[model samples]
Target: MKHARIGHQSIPRWAYLLFIVLAVFVLYRIFQHRAEVAKASQPPVRPVLVAKVITKDVPLYLDEIGTCSAYETVQVQAQVSGQIIARHFQDGADVKQGDLLFTIDPRQYQAALDQAQGQLGQVKAQLGLDRITLKRQQELRARNVTSPQDLDVAQGTVNSDEAKVKSAEAAVAAAQVNLDFCNIRSPINGRAGLRLVDVGNIVSGGNAGGGGAVLLTIQGLDPIYTDFTVAETDLALVRRYLGGPNVKVQTDLSDGSIPPRLGDLYFIDNAVQPGAGTVKARAITPNPDRALWPSEFVRVRFILDVLKDAQLVPSQAVQISQSGPFVFVVKPDNTVDLRPVKPGQHQEGDMTVIENGLKPGETIVITGQLALSPGAKVDPKPYDAGNPKSDRQVAAKGAM
Candidate 1:
């Protein structure tokens, strides 16, 4: 009505103040969000530890289970049958070749030898008399004092006597050999097993066809053998490098408490096993200390060949993703690039061989990979593998 109702009514001062406060609060939130977005859009810089790839020759090896065996096993037995008069070696003693192990009663053999010698002596005397008779008969025949038949008979007797003497000499030699066999000696340098027959036991010595009742067993321990098997599928590769000088082998106790023993491949079976489809192989290891025992199970590794100038990296540096094995490489510009790699053999003590996608002297991120992305800026630091504290921390973080 009056003056068009004064179009506007007067607002409270507190209301104006409240409107201003609300507007200011909204504007401040908008600015903070924009700032955060801008910061996020920029590349993220993460601190990480890096290591350099090394170049060296690394051996390729195949690992399998094996058994330790004596290189040579001999069954000790007496060669002649007689009473075991004495035993010269104790059970389980180390013996050398030709060492006397047992002594059999040689009196009978000696008597036989004496009788043979006497027989040989008698034959020789008879042969001498026959030779004189033949010569006298020949001279008498030449003088026409004796008939040709007499000379012929004398010659025949001399020939017969010579044959008898030869037979008697052979008998003496046989008797001598039997006497020598009475003294049982070690056939090889090795450790003897338990005595099968004690002293005073009459042992059958002659070839009983069953090795004469095994008196003892001797096993050559030094230069021991580790017999193992490999899959037939890998036979081609194994055969290729079989005789190569670079090929090597190692073995360790199955328990893994002792250090590995170094050796070389010595034998390969002519054919693969029919049922198992595995090829038998053996390695000879120098065991001067007798560290390896017969029939002991062990872990065997066959080193096929060495890759010269191959790239090596820390084992932890290799990461597995959907695209396969990859690693985060630290570029010279302090940026990390995700790279795919072809990983080869993984060696002991945390070392890995990279077949491709890496080069020697290149840097790789070893730790702090959780926060990394392709082309992300990084604050790289040299990784000190000798530092135990950091290793422990990394291990803890990985567990988490």
Candidate 2:
């Protein structure tokens, strides 16, 4: 029985070729996806702003939070008690020494002075008459017309009257002083604050109470004092460099319109503060415009010395981490090396002094540090702080 001869179905060469092509295409796609992922994993070349580490003479300054204090603060008060008759000066006026500030009731003082003067005149007349009588008595005694006792009595009367004249003179002088005090004058050259006692108010004098009621508050403005502190640990360093010549202090006022003022360091506390571990320091600065006020907070920069040929870089290049301050240094091949640095004084122009871990003429990454890692390649661009457009562009990139 021939089973109708079993026959085998064969696949066409074109179909087999098609299958091979599909398998090869799927494998290629898998490998291509892998290759793309690997490429994506590698970091791209970053564009960064760079600056050269410069060697120049940099003024070393210590910055501290400080306060502007008046050189002298005076509470203007009356020396003699009286009713305030008039206010001579306006509130918050700039006053000079001996400037009349207020006037008390001078009528009573004037009357007292007049009475004292009259008393003094009366005493003088009595003394004059006594002298005449004493001379006549002495002549009589010499000529035996009067007894010795009588002459002695006349001389004693003359002496007693002379004593009375002296007493009256002192009283008159004291009265004049009281009258002068009725016109209160500024004791210091300063700017006056609000009027404490208005016209028609009866104020006590210095003799009335421990201190007279404060009529006005005045604070010296020019050559003002700025009080700041330095950490106790830095005392030695501060003292060492402070001894150098041309050391100046700069004060940053709260008002931005005014430039930083130059001052001289005049005082240092004898002892460090107990708990804070800081030492009080003071500077005297001329405030001709009265820009600084008493108790106004300010920033004080004490320039101890100028470091010559120091390595410096833009301040933004320095970054802080858990270890310490570090900076990304760009190499010649555009690769960045994360370098730990010892940052020193920061200049007013955004330049910082690097004490270590950097050298002069070395390029440092300043702006694009956010996109950097160790050994990563970067496209270094020169950072020009003067260019406003470049700043905007950098800011834009940072936001992205």
Candidate 3:
């Protein structure tokens, strides 16, 4: 009590008063600093707000890798052994079915055919003589003028000559077929590759390596096939979305970097592939200009089904916390609320479907999630300010 009334134990009054003021000022500074440090240490966690946008028909697509190939291909080879007499059609030229591709030397086949025909004539003449003798002998034997043994000999000779004639006829037929094969023709209408053999070169049967010569190759390129695969797990989706005839596909050229050509799907594999766990599919595209070449790697896309009037939100708008999928809904009072949502399929650009949560006209943080609190003041801007395209799509649906 004495020290409190007389500062500094009976010291000067001005000195005691100054010391008291200095102590009071020091205490005020400490209290102010503590208040500031507490505020900084417990800073608020911000929330990224996005709009619970209404989802409408969004163009969805299933993209995959694929390859292009000709509809049909044929390798032309010689069927009969002969010298390659002449070559027809230029390299890489489009040819029609039955077009003469090469002309093998027909002289050997013709000579064989002529020889068989000559043999047939000789056998026929001998049979004629035998038949005449047999008829005479049978007539005489009936009258007892010829021996039975003579009639039997004549009959046997006629039968032997007839057999020889039949054999000669078969040989002639085979020779004629071989002659026809000397004129090599295209089996199908397509583009031709190159002539592997020059004129006057010897070619054996089947061109069995064609004496180191391959005639040509032809490929059908008008309507081409583009093949791709989808995951086996998505079989249900393929059945659902691919049923529509309007379902479109496109193929990219040059490592999928180029723009894709519009095509339509026509084939699907019946079973899943074992090694890759994928199901194969094929699409046909008209290549009047030969834009899709044979064996070219391609990037493909299937236009997914169009969702009719679905509720869509930004992909970033949906956040996963301890609870589940949620969006920070900004109320009119600028306070944020955590909105639990059930999401559906995603669509083109940056929109997704809202299955069970969120309603129209609900504003949520699209960005700045790291700075949001439950009751913190929110400066809600348009959801697509930074992303103009998304903003346009959002604005098209009337989301600000």
Candidate 4:
């Protein structure tokens, strides 16, 4: 029968369209939620600059501040009192041993020497005449014609004249020495400083003990000394290798005008300096070109030993944490492992020696370490020191 269907109404076309639209919107929402959850489950991949661990012979060394000093310093002084009549050398001239440096007036000394010679000649003539008289007296005594007292008197006169001759000879020697002193000579090979006494100035003689007026300063410059100090705490380590064959020193000037110089450790103070807690040390460096000067400050590196086949890496790859120094090592799967390392001395060319905790051929992060964590994924890029962009990135990241 027309039945209950007579009360049923047909569905509207607009209702069907609205239902389809809601179903499609629900499906989109579900898919979007699933995508967000998946993203949250995965770790973020960060980009970083990295380098490979290398191995080489690395030097174990200590760095200290030092100063260059002349190997030998001599203050040239007048050895004999006289007026400086002439200067034989220019200021700042390099001189050899026995080189003439100045000339003093010799006329007075020569006159004294002449006078002594004259007196010696007079004494010699008298001695000859007295000896002849003694011989005549001796002959008379033998013939019993002269008294013994006369013979004795003649002998005495001859002896007295001989004594006078000897006294004159002593005076001549003294005068000759004074004449030779007129020419001043350099005693050592060195570089002469400015002349303190001019050509016309009078200077007093200095004794062998370095007394009197300093005429000029001469310092030995070749093979100079680099003087430095070591802290008391490190004294033991330095002493252990004090004279070892491998132990050496390297010196660098702040100006960098000359190349770094290598030398041997020359001296070390026996006692530590009171109140300073340091001991003085010296290095003997060859300075054939005279590039190093006295009292010039320099950077000193005391090389204790060389570690053979030591693991090395870029210095920036090592980072310090609260526990100690650590490095980010990249794994084969592009993940990083935060590894603790025992770092050794930093070397030239931005390299550092790894005493422990790292192996050769391992990849390590040099930059972009701030965003890294243990087991974190990374896009490792090769570190290139020549790349400006990489350097800028490193600087911006504040990589250690």
lDDT of 2 at 9: 32
* Candidate whose TM-score is highest: 1
lDDT tens digits by residue: candidate 4, 1-400 = 5655655545667899999999999999999999999999987787788889999987888999999999999887776677889989999989999999999888888999999999999999999999999999999999999999999999999999999999999999988987888888888888999888898888887644558688889999989999999999998788787777899999999877789999998988999999999999999999998889999999999899888998989888899999999999999999999999999888888888899999899999888888788998888788996785865675455333
Better of 3 and 4 by lDDT: 4
Score residue 215 of candidate 2 by CA lDDT.
92
Worst 10 residues of 4 by lDDT: 391-400
How would you encode candidate 3's per-residue C-alpha lDDT over 135-242 as one tens digit per residue? 999999999998899999999999999999999999999899889989989988778876677889887676344442457789988788999999987788778877
Q: Which ten residues in a row have the lowest lDDT in candidate 1?
A: 391-400
How many clashing pairs in candidate 2? Answer: 0
TM-score per model over all chains: 0.81, 0.72, 0.57, 0.74
Error of 3 at 223 (Å): 3.6
Please rank every candidate by TM-score, starting with the best.
Answer: 1, 4, 2, 3
Please give, for residues 153-191, the per-residue lDDT of candidate 2 as tens digits.
Answer: 999999999999999999899889999999899999999
Candidate 2 vs 3: which has more TM-score: 2
Per-residue lDDT value at 71 in model 2: 94
Where does model 4 exceed 4 Å of error?
1-45, 112-177, 206-212, 394-400
lDDT at residue 137 of model 1 (Cα atoms): 98
